[model samples]
Target chain A: MTLTATSPAPAPAPAGPAPDLAALAARHGLVESGARPCLPEYTRRLWGRRHFVTAFATARLTAQYSRARLGQLWQVMTPLLNATVYYFVFGVLLRTKEGVRDFVPFLVTGVFVWTFTSSTVLAGTRALTGNLGLVRALHFPRAALPVAYAVQQLQQLLFSMAALTVILCCCGQFPRPSWLLALPALGLQATFNTGLALVMARLASRTPDIAQLMPFALRTWMYVSGVMWSVSHAVRGDKMPHLVAVALEWNPAALYIDLTRFALIDSFAAGQLPPYAWAGAAGWALLAGVGGFVFFWQAEETYGRG
Target chain B: MADAYDARTPTVIADDVHITYRVHSGRTAREVHAVKGVTFVAHKGEAIGLIGSNGSGKSTLLKAVAGLIRPARGRVYTRGQPSLLGVNAALMNDLTGERNVVLGGLAMGMTRRQVRERYQRIVDFSGIDDKGDFSTLPMRTYSSGMAARLRFSIAAARSHDVLMIDEALATGDAAFQRRSKARIAELRATAGTVFLVSHHHRTVTETCDRALWLEAGTLRMDGPAADVVAAYEAHAKAKK
Candidate 1:
């Protein structure tokens, strides 16, 4: 698009030779408009707006339930209802609960943990498209939208965790030393979800049709992630190909679900949590978290532009 | 008045900037050249007016300077972040005006403490509470004029390096127009360069010392605001 600079034709006499305007602007420390900052500076700017990210997330979460009659109760009720429905379908009808111990606690924990990742991914898909007004109106880091959506989903999950704890207590599962492990496991899962959310944010921002197709993809992923049944038992019985079994074991969602179950359920913990499980969780978090952040940051300047 | 600002300190430099928009219809794409090699230099403390006929690329040029749009060719350079005023006022309608003030302040890069400090002043400046406790109500309930006033008040709260306004001042009551005009003067006294895009030539002639006139994607005139407006008006009369 480069062309010769055709100076505007005006009658005003120059004091002397017209100095190069571009050179003058450069000498004065002016930078190109709409240019993306370097990675380090971008990170610094995003870090500086941490409070904005949290405030925005909290505001959106509050607004999400404001119009409903039950208001914030839905945060817990939605997951509880989903868990009940899954139990009826898989545990009762299909009798998938036959080999599973503490089926109620197992199903509730899986639903709550899986909800965190699914909701986060869904929110990320709309982070930019849904808030086009804010995106076009403001000049902050675009990553703030997806990260804030991830935080909002995490907040919702925390509420669901309280309900899950009550259900576990009802199922006669008392707290043990292994329960302390749930914190780090959640931290790793949150990181993984945030990273994946960032990836979805960029993808959906470009092709918003991806947002429509995401629910189907997430449903398919949930079925294979072993949310309702035992992945280990099914694999041990040789019901699937070896490669498929290995993939189901290593799948990030299943790995996270297993990590939470190992932390919260005494019966699951007694079966011996594999050493590779923790390693795989950490590996997925690092891969998705760091990779997704840089991927999103690469297109920072193009977020709101047509 | 001309000597008040240091001419050597340039705040915005649009060097042969060309902005083009791609319009897609059915199965064809058309390229519309909005701003063709428009170049100008703006200095600190100058309130420059951008006056043009409809579809003359005045708003497009301002967006390019604000870094909202990238020039397809050439470049625009600025001393600091150039804020486009009214667009930032596009806040959440479901949110209360009080919450919108906080959100808008943070969106403009203000710290939470700064927003808290300026909260009362912003509300007071908008005169939103003159009749009742309107700031507590959702912004959707507000009249268009009131909403515009609040938006202008929020943006005017912060002194920016380069501020680009697009017909935001045309709304509001006469008393409010007077208050906002004074606020613009206050912003200029702080050495901020202001770019005002308005269809009202009289407003341009009154608020700005210099003006840029664009026609058919080219810079048609650049001089004193009154002179440019007069020239543009005469051209329009001749065209009719």
Candidate 2:
């Protein structure tokens, strides 16, 4: 009987006298469903469920620090604390701030922006596997989980952005017209972070150990991306190979950090900024956002299944 | 029920569905064929009971029917989305019972306004309100029975096209089970197809019109609930 069901596809021509059960089942709306929804349809469904995504993200964020003494204030405190540590180590002790103007503000901006992407990537790794119960019991767009995690991180970043503004003001870097550019840059980075999260969500759902290994990988990425030290100053065009220097200059994270610094800081020379940084930001965002989404959607039906 | 089964549109059809699980124990990895070639057609307004002992693949088969697990060989077709009643189901442990009701209802495809409208009734139906402000407390603070009852209430709020209840009814008291059984009947009256998987023969016989008996991942019998339950009981008696 099982053989009959499995073998009906390759059987002789359909002109045979007996009506195939498989054909009958198909006619009666039976479908073998490991196939994912089409791109347009999946996007529509995901958009329709935006309320659920936002609500879930908000609920998770609210509960995230509820147990702590300061509650959501920890969102700002965490990065501020990290920025302080980096300021002491790299700014004071190691003199990473020697030639850099408004080093504290630059360090704070880097810490805040880098945390957004790194936390989003880490959270995306567990989006599906972490919510197996919800995935198994409910039938919604699974992409909602990862997208919600990204949204949660974005919300936290927005909260921390408030603290960042204050730090910049105290450091005597008043708001400039260029500071408005930080908005679009953050938007681009959010897109890139979401896409990276989607990719990591898919990967970590398949190999959960990726979640365990992401922090170290992200730390190395942080080092190379100039989160603590300026990659442009550390690796000069004359000192390093041209291709390597260009790659470092064009690194998406480095580009985003530099864009924010250009917007906020006065002494960071415009010539020091990577050329066409906005284009680079947009290009990386589109590539990762669209490619990562499609890559994740292709395996939509397999998520949360053992 | 028989007439409806004959006359109503088919809501679910399982076509030789086979579900396999990969089990890794220490060093050796092996495939466990949980559900092998079990196929059945369920029509609207039919309450079908899935009964088998431990390791019988009843839950596995139901998971396939709910689209939670993809079949290794065949497929399961449904008229609409099938909702599975899971005990823990991704509800945040730190959220209060009321908040979880909103989340669970939303997760089960209810709109925010719909969950809001049904909030009081869901809590009342689950009887969690009887604990005097317990519904306001975190879910982790509730007993397992209270949590299970709340989960059931949230799931049963909407009329599902196909509802699969797996072992959730057993977590409640007798009165709670009776109310859930009646709720299943009301769902059938609304032309919904229900698949109930339970080890309790009494619950199965009381709630289902048809029964499918599975043994070692194979369909042993599919018949009227009473006849199948009697046969299953006789087999158990013989083994004992």
Candidate 3:
């Protein structure tokens, strides 16, 4: 993949050095455009390249396990290992004395869903800076970078979800027909993730420092989101911990997973949910989704800078 | 052959654009004037080159013109859209080159179907062989030339009202340069404009019809590519 900088000997070689690319582009007025890049225009541009997005996501999923002895099995093995460890640690060791029959399913479902949200938020935040190559050389809507990241993460989650469903059903935990409702809940989770991604991708581009703290943030969020232990169970059903109580009332990942459980798990019933929880979770999704996108778009042009 | 261009409709116009960056202090923030009161015009089918020393504000001026930076004062008006090209424009190492090219194409505003349709054209132009698992490999493992090839293919594959290229072309092979130049000419002939930024004097003289020498964000020289490039080259040589 040579650049062809040495070129066919110009019929007559200019005795002096060749000018740099910058001088050449400007001298010709390519940079002379004064028009601002509109967000819709940029978005439309990204839309045109959707296949590239899907292809990239597919490649990322496949390549992640290329070097592992386990190969693509790592995809399933990763979440399995994660669920097992938490199940042992929280379900057995700390136990917090949970009484939600077959807590394993409850814990695994919540963690897997939460992992999707966290991974999307974490990856999307740094999507811009991490892909400086694509951002600078191309003129597509910059949002595609982060959206692509989220989509890639979602692909990985789909595998995890399938494995989770099989595990739960195999364990005599067949869900009610109403469990199909989980799809919309999952969609809302993704919507929230996309929004969070947009904001993070832009902010992370401006300061690489933000990316460094993401893993730690994800870990903290993991605790807050009740991936291992149910907040509803931890505070003993009657009263919830301050953060966990608030989370149960709002966190979409929690709501979405609970929606799944309400349809599947026998303990959960209609009266168990608070009135504002649905509204609050929806609000969370709206804010993160719309706010993240708008925030990122404002810095759309800046990402191209070196 | 020179591009058969229509010069009546302006491709680009930056009206006395002033751009400043703020350096904040605990006491008071100070603005760094990256560019000030700079204006220029470009017409369709013209290749313009910007030549200047490092930190001479050449890149800043180019960025301002590319719509990457908003001017503190005045405005940039384009008859059509402009695209900026850099390594950032081409591929991300974490993702495969193939994905990057498609992404690059899409970023340029082609539809998913359009990217798929042009996939072969872009891949072929990149000239990377079937070896090296181009689909599976991340660009971080690619050689500088490989990266540039993909970048070149992605950016040149599309047409634009205006295109701003940074110092990326210096890394390309001669064949690519020729191919890219022909492509640029093709784009311009179709009512597009090209803005090339480089320190390579010969490329400017050969590829551009006009040249602007940016010195500290000011437009130092704006005229025929041959004349301005010659003056700038002579000035650079004298300074050395």
Candidate 4:
């Protein structure tokens, strides 16, 4: 207990029953941990450095795949090509009648939306471990990391969707009536994916083995969500397909994808959704987002340790 | 320009800091107390060496000081930052060493352009001299020494108000060690507080004005470097 500037800072002292951190210092061995920054203080510090986060995101976006020649080009190309493969496989070969007219466009819309949801969650799962240095050395919102990934995903999604819009227009089936509904649908997807990202990332941090099974999880999700196949046949009379559709539709990711289809296929006014479904998706998003955050903050103390 | 600071204010106050890590093995979690009942104060312009043998909890204590770990039973107060050199640390493996410098600087709270402005010095400090594949070769390729040099250059590139260094500095050679020592001295001279964790008693005594000894997550001793280091060395050697 050698005296080294033991004088306390002359800041407005707290009056409320904020726990006396100093009193417990000896018992806790926190004699050196004087005034730890809380969430609000740290957030303001990080926010004041918003340009820093943006720069970090930009660097990550650019360098994440710098080794490849096509690099970011694949961000757009991969989705289009995926859409094309599904279009030919499901639309041409399966020769399924369009549940809605212009099935090629419909299939394309579904694949891209679903792709964003799956990929964002998969990549964001390692948001903490992948940037362990940044989290440990620098104090930034850990949420900012996954949010950055989402932002990066959103940027690419926005760009790719523009091209998607052009292709849809070229197909000469501009979804004017119901398309506006897709905005809320996309919002729902982003929110829900963010939530799942939190849960999975937290789980993965505790269990490294969890990351290995992500591919299998995503594949299972794809099938259940009714992305490539239509649920119309099942919805008519088959209890099995109806059961599967309801189960799949219960997933907010599927809800978002289905809404994208409705937005693109349903005419502007025709595509508008019943408030109940959107509200349902909204609830799922809230659960995933808030639940993920609490779960993450619970382990905030564990980060940066051996 | 004159410095404007509240001179009377204590920058750091850690009372009864207890950190425990649950060591996992085959589904069983054992509580390995990393730092137990540690109480210490760090003021501005102080150079403190956190010295301990392996499992002595020096690293864990340093981490707790940096606000990276949540003490299981205690509280920590830091005026602004009581964090390790790269507490939220890593050198981006895929990016070039130069890019790492920029990232490390920004992560330490320097602005983007500030990092870029000091780019040349960072590169020189890292001691990469026109090596081919410098940009293309992934950081995983660099030897541990080269990698440490790069990380240290980026981390040590900026002057921190309160900087904590783990055993990370041990990799560099004697010359680099001297340069590193000088940099830390400069930091202390300019009212910066440094907490260094090192097992090498010589390095700790040479670099820090004060030393702390931790044992199984508890503070055993804290005082002048020579006295503390001598006691720690004898105890360590005797145990061996």
Q: Model 4: per-residue lDDT, tens digit, A120-150? A: 8887777776776666556555666666666
Q: DockQ for the candidate 1 complex? A: 0.40
At residue A126, candidate 3 shows an lDDT of 70
The DockQ-based CAPRI class assigned to model 2 is: acceptable
- lDDT (Cα, tens digit) per residue for candidate 2, span A1-306: 111121123223233223243554455575544446699999998987887888889889988887788988898787778878988998889988877777898888888888888999999999998988788767788999999999999999988888888898998988879889889999999999999999999998877778889889999989888887787686764888888888888899998888888788887767877788889999999999999999999888878665
TM-score of each: 0.91, 0.91, 0.80, 0.78
Give the higher-lDDT candidate: 1 or 3. 1
Superposed by TM-score, candidate 1 places the C-alpha of residue A170 at a distance from the truth, in angstroms, of: 2.4
lDDT of 1 by residue, B101-195 (tens): 98788778889999999999999999999999999998889999999899889888888789887775546999998898888778767647999
The whole-model C-alpha lDDT of candidate 1 against the native structure comes to 0.83
| Residue B161 accuracy (lDDT) in model 4 | 58
Off by over 4 Å in 2: A1-19, A30-34, B1-8, B25-28, B170-178
**lDDT at residue B204 of model 3 (Cα atoms):** 86
Provide the lowest-lDDT 10-residue window in model 3 chain B.
B1-10
Which of 3 and 4 is ahead in DockQ?
4
State residue B238's C-alpha deviation in candidate 1, in Å.
3.7
- Top candidate by lDDT: 1
Docking class for model 3 is incorrect
Candidate 2 pairs with clashing backbones: none
Whole-model lDDT values for every prediction? 0.83, 0.81, 0.70, 0.67
Instruction: Please report how far candidate 3 places residue A200 from its true position, in Å.
Output: 3.3
Candidate 3 deviant stretches above 4 angstroms: A1-56, A59-63, A66-69, A202-218, A234-248, A264-272, A275-280, A298-306, B1-7, B21-32, B87-90, B94-100, B130-147, B170-178
Q: Can you tell me the DockQ of model 3? A: 0.16
- Ranking of predictions according to lDDT: 1, 2, 3, 4
